[model samples]
Target: MMPKFTHIENDRAKMVDISGKGEVVREATAAGKIFLRPETLKAIREGTVMKGNVLATARVAATLAVKNTASIIPMCHPIPISSISVDFTDCEGYIEAVVVVKMTGRTGVEMEALTGVSVALLTVWDMVKSAEKDAAGQYPVTAITDIRVVEKKKGK
Candidate 1:
């Protein structure tokens, strides 16, 4: 029979204990999209977004976000991240950003990867919004449509 659900002895919320789990290397990749106006897209492509580098700033922000993921998410266990890569692609009317996080530790780095992508996108939006805001003074809409782990491998 499958095990039945049981509450923790003293806590009201359920939590997973990783103390007994074997340490293993794990990695996760997450991606997100940012839709923008034609002019905004051109500015980014032409290297003229407020005289700032959108992709470069986003990349740095993503790396920092990955390292601080645990502080932002309550249940995430702080893990030592080995490397992080952020990529940006220009899609005619939109921009796609991808963040891949790698770690050699006991816990998976899925949250870190996701957090990186999210914060990076937000930073991009902030940098361009001043020029991309609509006539009504509302910022261009940004969305994080999908976030998922694309790959995983168990360490030997």
Candidate 2:
């Protein structure tokens, strides 16, 4: 048996329709972690990263990503996002980016939240790539992982 896909109909790919659903307040929170070398983490902590304030830059990137997620993801519906929040947590040898997206619409904002977290983590990596690179100019110790929607809520 073939698995069903919400974006597929009659052997054609299509965007899912939420038009018949009533408008509701929807929110989603997503999180991802970027692992870095000890030195890279220290540089971010000391505000000495070459690019600039890493978290602030990431936050802006996340906000934009949330708003533009529909463009990047073909099946995602264009949603009216009411609020977006981005936050970062500094931990041992890693940093975590969390994004929360809220909107009153027929569809949920999980894709937007996931996109925000992904872009935020990527921005963090870009900001610190110089410090994270080895003599061979490779990022052997840098990685982004665990991108997921940690929370989703909807209310009438």
Candidate 3:
């Protein structure tokens, strides 16, 4: 019971203590999409985005985000991540990012996976915003959507 309520102490917030929990293989996959104009997508496909290779930069960003999730999101434990895979798909008017994080720890890595996808999509938006902007200098068609943990597994 106390372990279940570890995050709360004296009406204030606290990090949960997983000191006694057994370590197991944990894996999580998360995905998200970023919508943009057709022209922007074309530029990305052609490797002509002003900021250089969009997918490559986004992949680096996703890996970094996966490694540093605990720093970005408070209350997350700084576990040793063993593997990270970042994949991207270019679709009509959208680009999708899928991130997988694996670790041997007491807690699952769903949060790290989700954070990687979010940052990857955001990095894509950053790299392509110039191309996505309209005459008014506003990103009318640009948006990030459907960020979620697609799968999570433990001890496998």
- Model 3 C-alpha lDDT per residue in residues 61-104, reported as the tens digit of each score: 99999999999999998999999999999888898999999999
Model 3 error, position 103 (Å): 0.7
Give per-residue lDDT, candidate 3, residue 155: 97
Give the distance in Å from residue 85's predicted Cα in candidate 1 to where it truly belongs: 0.6
TM-score of each: 0.85, 0.91, 0.91
Q: What is the per-residue lDDT of model 2 for residues 67-113, given as tens digits with 9 covering 90 to 100?
A: 99999998999999999999999998899999999999999999999
Candidate 2: list runs displaced more than 4 Å.
Answer: 1-11
Which prediction has more favorable TM-score, 1 or 3? 3
Q: Residue-wise lDDT of candidate 1 within 1-156, one digit each (tens)?
A: 998868657766544688888888787888888888888888998999984999899999999999999899988899989889999889867888888888787788889999998998888888898887778988655444555566656575
**Model 3 alpha-carbon drift over 4 Å, by segment:** 1-11
Deviation (Å) of 53 in candidate 2: 0.9
Question: Which candidate has the top score in lDDT?
Answer: 2
Question: Which structure is stronger by lDDT: 2 or 3?
Answer: 2
Q: How far is candidate 2 from the true structure (C-alpha RMSD, Å)?
A: 4.2
lDDT score for candidate 1 against the true structure: 0.84
Give candidate 2's TM-score: 0.91
